[model samples]
Target chain A: MEVTEDIIREVEKGNRKITLDLYHYSFNVLMSSAVRYKNHKEDQMEIVNNAFVKIVKNIKTYRPGTAYFSWIKTIVKRELIDDFRKNKKYKELFKIRDSDSVQESVVEPEVYESMDSESALQMLNVLPPATKLVFNLYAIEGYKSKEIVEELNISYETVKWHIKQARKKLKSLIIENKISLKQ
Target chain B: MKEEKDHIDDFFKERSEQSSFEVPDSFLDDINSKLDVLDQKKKRRGGFFWLWTLIPIGLIMMYVLWPEDIEINKTKPIVSLENQETNAEGALMDSMDEQKSESILISDSLTEENITQEKPLNDTENRSAEKLKSLKNVLQDDVKKIDKLADENNPLWLKEEIKKQEVFNSSNSNNESEIVPPEVEEMAIADSNPEKNIETRNSNINATENAEIEGSETDFAIDENVNNVVVSVDSLGNSESEDSIINNEAFEIDSVQIDSLPTETEDQDSTLNVEEVDPSETMLAGGNREKGDKINHEIQLYGGVLNSSSNLILSNDSSTFPMNTMESNLWSASFGVMYRAKIKQLDLGAGLSWMKTGEKANYGTNTLEMAEVDSLIFIGWQTDSVFNQNTETWSIDSIPLYDTTTVTTYTNDSIFYNTANKYTWISIPLRFGYRIDVNEFSFIPRVGIDLSFATGSNTGTYAEIINEGLTQNSSSRFILSYALQLEVRRSFDRWHVFVNPYFRTNVTPVISSAIQIRRYNSWGINAGIGFKLK
Candidate 1:
């Protein structure tokens, strides 16, 4: 069902019944954003629920005529990051430099043609959590490096370094998968 | 290279957006249930705020209403003595009046009879009577001096004077009774009921002689005095044979009591000294004050780190957990306020603490085979009566329904998730401890029971039962646990600092859900500052 202005108004007024409808409407977008940070479906579901809880709590602050999907996506991403920060092990990995060197050889564009999103996501998991998060925010989510730096509270050099490490790891994974597929 | 990068980024973004996954039917129900829980938590938070606010007020009211200890010191003993006298004076005066009336009755009867059979004996009896009268005067003077010394708060001097008076009273009464003339005894026996007159005189004399003993020994003295009186009566060779036999028995009992007097006097002396302290006097003012009398309240503020490990046990024997399930120990922190009261070497206390404890679990992916049960409805033929308008008769028709049950098996791959399950609780611990002091430091070993309320929890992954579709977690709001600790403390005037090492475990499993039961056991150390409220 399409969401209208009247539904948004009722939801903003703490109508929990309408808020559930909103949950169903935005389930896909929330799941996709949650999956970038969490590897498990259960944790992703948890992140989505937490995001809806925030959206319902602060719906009144949303400006009308703005893109509602973008607004909800921002809330979901924030929830994902918050959940990630709860794990101290992941937080510690955010500062460590990846020891594996990036091979300078570039992959042919045809190599990526048959690769699906599930395999790509699995390949992305090989990178450290901080590098994966930075790459997803910058390369896929279209967030600028400066915006990433401000959100993550990291220096520009650190942001560039993580993206570089993420690219190298993804390239290595793609080449390995191609070789295995050929075999 | 730049063009290839753009194409690669665009392809990855498109694949991610196009990727689709199915949501389970139970997913919506789970979200709604979580929303309801969040709503309830919001309401409870408001109630908890007011509850927390009222707790300190209730404590203050208890402190205000506590009974105060009364102090009795050397300079203030007169005040304490006055209180005792004011409470006991009416009872004492009433008993004294009864004794005086009875004694006067016996004396009047005795004075009416004059024995003039032997002049020298009469002279000796007269001199002895004068001596008895002089002794009575001395007893009365001693009583007056006791009252005066008691008003002056001189317990030592008063105690010595009482001992001197009792010795004189005891020895004089014995000598005076033995010297009574034979004619006087004959006059006593010539009364209408000789036994009754003799018994009355004996009781009167004993009351006067044992006045001090009665005041100190109470019921014990009464038995001894009765026996002594009966012994004197037996010496008279009364006409009644039964009375003579009874007096002989009394003489034997009196002899035993007379022999036990010195041992009994030492015991009674100790009792008298304790009675002098008076129950109304506080320990601080009493000469036998101890360390416990100095402090009434000790408040401690503390913080500590807990290394918690969770043990998960299967809830049912139907299925065992998968081999890949793993948990790692997690670290959390707690802080609390504790109030204790010291009585001698024992410390009793209760405290409120907020603590977080949980573990990180990794449930790796696996192929799970689940069984589902489904019911199928079939239409069965049955006979039914139908009304026929024309024939006015019933016809049989067939209509039927039956249920059939079937089980279906499905194999699916379980999702992998690593969850850091954190649970927060507000705990109230009731503690008991014994303090042992060594040099400048005190070591206190304590044990306690904690009543904890689960304020909230953050959890993502759960161990699920194969066919039941159930997850393991706690649904109950309260958890009970036991704790043991030892505190090493160093004192600085009214303030002190301490480091406490402690171990705590849930008495019962804290988490019992569909799949498994979980118990949390933790080891921790806390350091805190304490202040005495005296």
Candidate 2:
């Protein structure tokens, strides 16, 4: 069923069924980007539940009849970022051992067209944590390069490099999967 | 270069547009637990607020009912006490009677008319209780002064009464409440036999006997003796004054008004406005989901029979089956999964499906001719007579080049051959449809595009039109098709049973050539059921 303003009000009040439905919706929406370390067996459910807890706590701050999804997405993203900040692996993934690591070329544009959304998301997650975060913010989440730079607190070069690496990683994965451009 | 980059962006856009996704089942349980916690918190908060609200009301009641700053009148009426103990008892009886009068005033004040209307708020009900209490205190004070008043003359008692009646006089001037005003009290006493004034004093001698009936309206049993004194003195026949004292049952708990009634309509109007209480107003345990969950695409699996016809029929005889098209009444079955979206009554879908479009057709002739023969010509009889000129006497000399009994034989007779053009394609269809519901049934009308690509195909007789004369073999295998369908569906729980009748025509000819290509139009009537799995 389509969620409406009234539904959102009910959802806020902790109406069990409506809240559950709303949570499931939020979980699915943010899971792909939020649960980055899929191979590490990171619990997407736990991350989403925590995000929901935050959402419930701050639901009153949300304006009725406003863009609820965008507001929720922001909260979910923050929760994911908090998780990343807490995880030691996330820190290691981005720590520069040397300043001169090889940077790959931009991915072939046709590669994205070829893969289905599920496979594409999986491929997207395979990128290094910093690169995946930058790419998702820029490409899927519609954040600008400047905004990402500020958000990640990285220099312009590193930000651009991460975006490039994310694309290259996806392009490589597409080639590995042997899928071609399909309409 | 820019266009190529745009293509990449478009790819990402399309991929990201697939936002309607599935999640793990346990997430729902997590949400449920969070909501339960939220509900518990909400309940606690609500109870807390209610408790807080009650405190103020409770405090106001206490403030009104508290026995605060009650002072007794010191100077007393110089009435002679025949016996000291009996005067004390009479004083107690008068106090009890005043208490009853205070109750009646309280009840009168609490009526709906008084509560709702504010003009009369501080009228009879407001000061009557205070006056009654003051009157009770005066009776007590009078008892204490009885010994002193006893020393004075009996005539001085009435004169002293007249002299020190300032409070009663003030009550008559200030209060319009039912407890008798001074004028009425005086009139009742004046009409009374002045000879019975002494009798009035001794009649309430038993007032102190049963003062134990406290906090009860039925203290009327003890109040009767006191009432007789007033009733006998009330000889002016002013029954209303008598009724006032009789009706004044006084307070069961000595309650007092905490606040004045609000006279304005605005407050009442505001109260009415606040009644639209949201039943679902709950303190949320978790964040709310955005209202952007679209009509999500579902994975649907449906299989049914279909009949299809195409321009490319394989036939030995080319006239009836022009361009060697695929014939009609060809029953074929198909099954495929669709990314389906249902919006209210509207149903939308796109899917990849495969089906064959052909059946075996019969045309005569077993002979395989390299070049097709056009026609056969007959010779005139005069042509053979040229031979007769040379032999005028040699009559009919073998009809010249052809003799009289000449017979011509053709190559071969047409045979009953069985051959068919079987073509199969992987078709992708996008449909937009609306469903109308009636009871347990729904009628759906739909229109969409079908892009059919050749996946597995057999050329049939089109292969037969080879190098000898005709040589065009279509290399193009993609077809852009359109369809119209009507589906009647019956839903049962999460499963739906439907029969869809559809007609499809390829916008791009099945035979893509600009030349004499025939268009393929096909119809399918499928009966299938789909389970809703989200």
Candidate 3:
């Protein structure tokens, strides 16, 4: 959805409800990202607040041609990555691998689809930040593992491995919860 | 397989679509309140920064208002009374001169009369009578002059002068009248003759008065001029016969005068004597009086007891037990204040502390009972030697080794064996000890008994499965036992670091059965640093 000038003006003029509505939208996006990428709630809130502040400050820079949602998504992604780097948790997720094909079988669609979105997100939150980021990009966002590698400055195989591990943990959680599913 | 894959995909997609996440209510309120507080703090910071600037000014005002130097003045009175007595003595001497002139005139008139009477030789008897009367008049004039001087001046001074005159007169009288001595004897003998007796009595009275005056003067000089008068009196007593006669008269006169004036002089002398006596006695008494003060100020007594033990040590042993094993290291510390009594250089104190040791060993051989079981041993070993830098490193190779033999053989070739193993006991050390202080540092060496309690049991046993006959199972048995230990600690301020190498022996045998297990006594070293609370 386009963030119209009217909405921007209303937010900047301190319209409480309008500002809260805008904030709520951004908060949801950031909270989703935090749940999908950071294990510690305290650290996730930090990532979310950082993304929200950037969005609030730079929202005026939103141009006509650019997709606003994609722009917002990009900001959230970048913030999450920055949070990972700042905390030095990124290294814990990715390891050096010689072959990209070695990690291909690790990520399974059934594991991701087996649980409800909220449950899957909660499971994702438990993953190391970099691994969760790689899993979100490769599996949920449907980005190619190589594209994820480029976006995150990581090896293609590391992206594949993170997706595989993320799916495996999600599968374990599903089994532990004993949630009935169609499969 | 394709149908199953499609079904699984459908199942997950459907579940994902139904899931939703909601923010907790408390979280939103907490965030809003935090933001409000942050804004308030930001606003107040401006005022707070300005307020902080006044702190240094306030401190400067306090410094200026503080009191400056304090002044104290104390005064005391001065005492001395030597000038008053000298003035009184000078006034008495002037009165004596007036009396002496009158006596001289009387004597001169008597001599003139005697000459006039001698010219009328026709009345010879009257001339003799006149001569005797003139002689009597001369003697009476002399007596009058002496009495006037004695009454005017200090009696002691007058008596001294008269004794000298009497010595002179006696010699002259002896020369002029060879019979004077005989006559004087006859006068003394003629008690019936009232006139002669009266003359004798007057002479005796004069001599006694002189003696009394002399005694009083000597006593006064002895009391007032201690060193000089004592020397003079000694010399006078040692002088020749004539001098002795004079001194004897003076002494007689002094004694008489002293007796007569006892009411005034003795009372004053006694008062002065008492005053002088008390201060000298107080000085001597004060010398010993400070002993209580010295004891109160000079002695300080402090004492405490400290116990320190090593927390952990690691060791490896084989043969009797498992072939490879690891042990944990443990240490403990306890400190307590002791009632300390210190006299001069010696210090004495008593204190109590607690200690504990945990250790375990595993045998490689699997027994029939343990054949299907897998076990892991968590070994904790601690020694007091950790604080000792000079302690010889216990070579891992030097640890005592023991062997075990199978007591029972089974059909499966499994054998049961027992081996001896020794473990250190946990100790609570109570020490009554002392330390010598050298400079600011103290070197303490203490001797105390370690009251060790059996905390845990350690036993080593060798065993094999009955079916595995060819496979010999060697096991070491461990049973917990208690022993005594001795420890020494060196302390610094609140931190005490020490190393204790202890000897521990098993109080009970490893195996109670037929096969005697050769148990090795375990000797370990431990060291640790501890803090004192009191």
Candidate 4:
């Protein structure tokens, strides 16, 4: 379902019915941002639902004619960051590990090309917590090393190293599986 | 290798854009439940917020509308008597020395009607005035005895004075008369015996000296009481006979004129000019009063130069350098206006400032090598023929054997240049300051955070590698900093001049550009003037 201005207006006017419709429509976008960092589906759902509640509460701050998806994505990212800061267990995941170097052999292009997004995501999930987050930000979210440095307060070399490590692990995961039938 | 990396990044970026995972059916239900709880909490919080906000406002309104009549009779009457002692010729001697003592005698019947029109007494004030009236009667009786004693022709005055004291004692025992001031009672007792009157007068002088030492508050009260009696007489019509002075105009106090009769003479005609005393000034004359108002708000304008210390991050990759400018000097400057509102001893303030930090710096020297092309080299010797004008025959003379050849020589030179690099920031500082005052000077210490935004910037020359066509790029547009400040202020009436010395440092780098990252911590002294707003 597409979100119309009428539905947005209804949600802003405290209509719970239209709010549910808006939630279902924007669910996939919210989940996409929440899914990368959280390991459990329940925690991912929590971050998305909290972000949705914030969007509904502060709906008046939403400027018209701007990209609604970008705004929603920003909120979801902020919710993820807040979760990271509050949860002390995330500190263990953020510790920089002495990762092995990338192998000399590169994975053939056909293997990556034939890979389904579900399998690709599974391959990406196998990377270390920090490496997975850095790769998602650098490749999927299109963030520069400098922006990642500012966001994570990490060194430029650390961000570059994580990206390299994530690529190496994902390539190895793909080579181990070779080509699999689409589920 | 770069292309291979780009390929995987492109694939993931596309996948992330095109793919959407299935959301569980219960996700929407969960959001609805949270939304309902949030709505309930918001409603409760909104109600509480209004309730809390209106309470103080309601209290303030009630206080503002309350009546002023509750403050009735709070201030006492202000009065000062210039006692006039008249001689036999009736010339009034306007000297305090001529008066017998500083002790004031209150009239026995100074009621609401007996007061002057300028100061009308309420019913409560009149009750206290009437109590003072009873004391006046005792003083009046004593004045009569003194007047009778002044008759030196009566050689039997001593016997008559004794007989009157006995009568006064009998009246005091019978009617229970109002208590007279101790000094007045002593005067009456001393005058009864003419032989020891001089010795008793010396004792009264000693008592006056004791009153002065005790403090001025007592002196002010006694002076005002005595002036009230004179004012009461003046309120009525001035007359020669004691009866006319008592029975003249608006109100009558019994025997009020008898107290004035000692100074009254037949030839005296000048009426006393009543001096109105200010109660507030009289209280200050005691020198023991609290200050009336404290300054609650102030706005100051200040500006100064500072010495800055900064760490610069430079990159070696000259191709993709974001910022082309770097500052070599450490001098910076800033100026701004601030407004402070005091809550008791602590003050909270916010200010807007413009701070400039970077300066022109030398980029580097550029050396260029060029080949010098114009050179003649000797290769081999050759004969040259020359003809003499007089010989008419061809003659060959060897001037010099030379051949033209190309030779390359290198020239080395360097060109030096500097670029103007400046960074301007519009900053807002929120601070908590405490003021300590000593005499006319005050020292205030402040600590707070500063939030700044880079509004303007220009590129400067830096290092040996110069990238052409690259503009200045600010790494971070916003920066948070902290500062410590101490203000030394000298007050002059409503306006004050102050010198504020401060130290500030950015929590994050203000400019985190690719080539050069600059973060500045500076110390500065600012001087300016401020006015008391309230």
Candidate 5:
């Protein structure tokens, strides 16, 4: 199940059992990509399944010397973007819209101290698809506004708006969840 | 805990933490199972590829071998007419030769009862002469009533003469006796056979008997002059009495025919005799150029294989599907060659075709932000389902000040997703249309209903191939469609090369519901040759 030259070769040859084994072994390595690009309310399991199918389909085109996990991550990102682009929910996210004073809700780091990473992910899942994507890109992936605009094909201001909205939604989710925990 | 106000930007910049969520237990198994199912489809399509070749070829061979005009040519003798006959005597000899070999049935009648051949026609003796004289006297008396043989050039006159000569030769073998009786001999043959007149009377009695008699023996006696008695059997007289029937041969033998009539049974008698059977119009039904010419009907058979071009109406107004669809080379082909007849300038025809056709389009609901929305955009897809937004207010008084806040709830409206819509239809088309052959090509525009009995894919207005594989559309539906068929034909002897372009449209929608309606319209061209099996 190790990501090796022979394993990659067998997967490329369309050995179904080997493909399944490789998928199981590489689950943890691929999970982050699936989570990062996953849209709000979309099933992470379904995304993983779609990503695995695409991986197997493109196995023949995979370069042996290249980083296998990166290749898989790239496919996962594409699948998520495609999933968002195809749906009617998030198509307008990158378009030019009114850039005005957004309602901002900021929280202190002390609130996140007691919060588990699982809780953080669940909170991130509540943001609208474009806002979530922009937040992941700007905060986690560390892409600048211009890079985000070029990569996501969005106006610079739209990306900033998404970042702001994402923070507000994340703050709200954290506050609501913390209150619920206290209750 | 007292909350500290920090910019949302600082909160985002502060975190670079990994998230942990438990993946589903059977997640790997689910992907593998789906992969297996999708893989099976690829295999099945591959398997059908070879069948595509063999199936159409087998169908073409079957169509080529089917009997189209076979029955028309069966009765014509294999022997050449020139070799068989030179003059009137030779013609009689030919008819006699046919009758001798065929042993045509004249069942339970005159020759069946009274005219017993003590010996064959070869037995030219005194007793045979006496018998012939007696039979001749009786036959002439009956035939005397049919005196229309007054014209020597007439075909009926010749039938009458041949009948008398055969009777004479059966009675005695003399070359001079063969030449002697022209009209008188026919009168003798016609008049002498009282039982033949009686049998004719019986066939005349009913419509059923008329069909039976035509089936039994409707041979219009062909003479040496090739003059044929086109039997006006009803003209002969349907009366039960022999006297009235005898009187009716006044319209005597008007039509002419030589090919053997297809009777159900044959008489065992080896002598050549005119079969006195019923009368119906059997002139044209027999297969031959001669029989065909008399009827004024010509058969035109065409066989062609065509590839069709069709499209799926993905959206009501081509929003998802623009005029130029990013299409692959996915098309369908059909082979069906029909038979048409030229009735002067107008041609009428019908044909059966085996068609495997489909319409495919990839349609997705692109996220449409009415005003570039970031807040959960809630709006109805249509006019009717407007979401009811209800608001309630709560107020909290702090530091001797009162503040009010509003909470609004919005209804859920359905959103569209990206779907790869694909539908495959296998239909059997039964088409009837009018064809016009101008110069080398014929245009046949047909209107008929096609039965789409087997299919797979999306059942909506169009098939949507979503990010998730193809939608299952398995149920069969009837589609009304029309075809503007163009054919280029080159005929060689009895064979021809037919290239028909099959263009068809569905008048009815491929998928229709209360909200949406879609149609499968296509234009395709197929090229193949076919044979005429006559």
Candidate 6:
């Protein structure tokens, strides 16, 4: 349903159901973009809040007919990037590995059967930011490596390399946890 | 592998699962209450704005529409007082004329009865006596009526009554035989309205008698009264002609009195007169006097130590030529004194300033950075300029550079560097500026031409490089520079404390033998504190 002034009024009047509904809609859109970029739920909440403040403050600047979710998604992505820059952690997390000059091998399908959904996500969180973003955009969001390179302003080779590294890291994390469980 | 794909896809799906976001109930309540207070404040402010605007408008409308009625109300009493004064003077004259006519009638009656009543001695005398008694009775009765009318109608009756008492005392003692002649009496009787004439003549006679008795006591009063009457009559007849002459005489007398007054008293009284004086003329005189008192003087002592990394006088192009990093922080202080004369708001000044800037830098790439460069530029400039709060334009010309430096470096495993780069030159900086001021703080942006003339023989080893510097290649050339300067100052009495920040750019090429060693531009930022004493 379209949100109107009446919905805002109802929300302001302590109508829990309506306020929660609208908030959930905005939160879902923002969380999807944040996880796609960073693959970690730990920092996702802070990034989403920052994006939410920007959206609320500059709501008038948002043009309708354009994709509302994507517009909010871009803000979440920018906020994450800004946070990394401010902390001086972007270089460490995204630095290209010397060995991964070309695309690395993708994880085999057999590996997925061994882990549940929750375990798989736990493994994805441990992957580095560049690897995680590349994997999410390529495997999950169905973006091509060339498109990812254009969007992130990196070389096509860098995109291919990040995805391969992500798969290797996730597969190793699952295998290491499995061995621990067996022991 | 298919199961692995399914697990990864399920992980993404699980991560994407959205949770509801709920705003705290207290936050909305707090915002609504704050908004209510804001609305109240806004309403109050809007009311105040309209109230402020309406009061002056109402006052102005009242002044414009009601001025004529207000003026008439003020002038009405003054007009009435003038009329009262005029009427009093006319009544006094009329009474005096009536008194003269009455005296003549009395003399005529006395003479006519005396001539008619002459018979056998005793009888004739008795009849004459009775007629005289009857006439005395009529005169006494008429006098009583006049006294009653005077008491009821006249404000000056008390003074008149005192004069009448004096007249009665003097006339009672005067000669009794000066009675009216028959021919004169006949002429008086022949007048058309004899009875009225007789009464008027009796009043006139009584007035003459009063005048004679009280003449000494009332002389000043009578003279003043007569003069006022004559002036009032003349004024009424041809007021413009008479008023001009009277006003001129009055003005001359007033001026003499004013001139003789003490100057201090006149000055004190001038404040009172200011309201009375024409507003436009007073404003003009006040403005001129203030302008005449305008004076300005400035003294600046700006001394600071500035440390900079390099003497690389080239613009930084980060993509191409890397910065020649250096470590040198030079400290310099300058003292300047300026005296300005202001004509109205315009200021003209001349100032002398002295400054010394020195720097040392390591030149060449990392392996070749063994060479150290040292230099000093001593600047002495005398400026002639004009400045106001808005704008300033100045011309400065003086000997600028006297430098001594040594450089040593290894090239191809052998030492090669210039150790001397000392020389003197004159630089004239003609600057034009505009400033914007907030409170007393100002931002001044300036553009200028730096004209340099090499004065002496190039003594430094870097003279070759200097000759290779574009403008220095010629004996004289121009360098364009743009600068933004901000001066923050607080003026206290005659002294001012100020901090100035200056950023300057050079826009001319540096050349040596048609080869460019340094580019034509350089940028520097300097901050210093200074005081103004005037």
lDDT of 4 at B193: 35
Candidate 5 chain B lowest-lDDT run of ten: B238-247
In order, the interface RMSDs are 8.1, 11.1, 9.6, 5.1, 5.4, 9.0
lDDT, candidate 1, A1-183, per-residue tens: 655677778875546889788888888888877776678778877888889888877777777677778899899878876776677675455675545557644578899998988888787667777888888888888887767776777776687678767776787788889999999
Q: Which residue runs of candidate 2 sit more than 4 Å off their true CA positions?
A: A23-27, A35-42, A53-71, A85-94, A103-112, A179-183, B1-13, B67-534
Quick one: best lDDT, which candidate?
A: 1
Model 2 residue B41 lDDT score: 87
Tell me the tens digit of each residue's lDDT in model 5 across B362-450: 44423222222223322323223333345344444322222222233333333343433445555545555565676655565555555
Q: Estimate each model's TM-score.
A: 0.39, 0.33, 0.26, 0.40, 0.40, 0.30
Model 1 misplacement above 4 A: A1-183, B1-45, B60-287, B291-295, B316-319, B323-325, B367-416, B465-475
Worst 10 residues of 4 chain A by lDDT: A99-108
TM-score for chain B considered on its own, for each of the candidates: 0.46, 0.34, 0.23, 0.36, 0.37, 0.28
RMSD of 4: 22.4
Model 4 interface CAPRI class: acceptable
Residue B163 accuracy (lDDT) in model 4: 51
The runs of at least 3 residues in candidate 6 whose Cα sits more than 4 Å from the true structure, single-residue gaps closed, are A1-21, A32-42, A58-71, A85-92, A99-114, A142-147, A177-183, B1-534
Every candidate's CA RMSD: 25.1, 32.8, 33.0, 22.4, 17.4, 31.5
Q: Which wins on TM-score, candidate 1 or candidate 2?
A: 1
Sequence-dependent TM-score of model 6: 0.30
The parts of candidate 3 lying over 4 Å away from their true place are: A13-16, A63-68, A96-114, A126-129, A168-183, B1-19, B23-534
lDDT of each: 0.61, 0.52, 0.40, 0.58, 0.47, 0.42
User: How is the predicted docking of candidate 1 categorized under the CAPRI scheme?
Assistant: incorrect
DockQ of each: 0.16, 0.16, 0.06, 0.24, 0.17, 0.09
**Model 1, span B1-534: residue lDDT tens:** 445556666766777787775565666777888778777776787799789757854774565455444221121111111111221221122123234322222222112012222234466778655554554344335434434544555345334434443443444456645544443343223222323432333343344434443422211111221222111111111122111101122222111011112343332221111113233332222133332244357889999899998866765555645522577888999999888888778988887899988888786645455443545567576577999999999898775544434455667766666777788888888899999988769999999999888875434356565433325465347889999999999998889999999999987777776566777899999999998775
